[model samples]
Target: MYRKKSKAFYERMLKKYPDVMSIPQMSKACDVSSKTGYKLVREGRIDSLKIGRNLFVPKEYLISYLLIRDENNVR
Candidate 1:
C-alpha cells in the first residue's frame, strides 16, 4: 500500500513518464530487467493495471515506487 505523498515528490517521474505505461517500457526507462519490473508489480510493491490480460503501471505508482526506494536507500 502506498501513500499519497506531496505532488512535488512525484513531479520528476511524472514528467519523465506518461500517465500510464507498460511494464516493459517502465523497466527500460528505469534500466532494470523486465523480470524485476514484473516482480515489483506482482509483489504489489508497485501498483498496476490489468487490462485485457496486459499489465500496465500508472506514472504515479511508478513515482511512488521510485521515491520510496530512493528514500530507503538514502538512510
Candidate 2:
C-alpha cells in the first residue's frame, strides 16, 4: 500500500532529479540551504554516502526523510 505511494513518488522525483544527488542538489530539491542539508547528514536525520570529498544522497533516503517528517509533523 504505502510502498506503492513511495514508488510513485520516486517516479515523480526521477523526472526532476537523479537517483543519486550531491548535497547541493539535495538541498535544492528539499528547498533548504546547503548548510541545512549538510547538517541533516551530520545529525543522522538523513543517510548519505561519503566518497573522498563528496557526499551523495540516494533518492530513497529523501523519501524516507520526508515520510518521517510528515509522520512526526516536523518542520
Candidate 3:
C-alpha cells in the first residue's frame, strides 16, 4: 500500500532544514503543480518569501495548509 505523507512528516523535514524550498520541492511535497503553487502564492493562500527572483514557502505552513484543505474537501 502506498502511504501518503502526514503533516508531522513535513514538520520534521522543516525542523531539519529551515532553508528556502524550491518550486520543484514544493510541488512534490504538496503534490501540486508548480503552476498551481505559484497561483496559490499569488492569491495569498500560501505565504512566500521572495529573494531576488526566487520564491520560497515555509514547509510548515505549506504542509498545514495542504492537510487542512484535504480534510475540508467538499467532494
| TM-score of every candidate | 0.75, 0.82, 0.65
- Top-lDDT structure, candidate number: 2
Instruction: Decide which is better by lDDT, 1 or 2.
Output: 2
Q: Each prediction's Cα lDDT score?
A: 0.80, 0.84, 0.71
Residue 16 shift from truth in candidate 1, angstroms: 4.8
lDDT of model 3 at residue 73? Answer: 62
Best by TM-score: 2
Task: Please write out the lDDT profile of model 1 over residues 1-75, one tens digit for every residue.
Answer: 545456586576457677788999888867789999999899998899999999999887887787787667631
Residue pairs clashing, model 1: none
| Model 2 lDDT tens row, 2-51 | 33245466458656899899999999998999999999999999999999
What is the overall TM-score of model 3 with all chains considered together?
A: 0.65
Rank ordering of all candidates by lDDT, starting from the highest: 2, 1, 3
2 against 3, candidate with superior lDDT: 2
Give me the displacement of residue 6 in model 3, in angstroms: 6.5
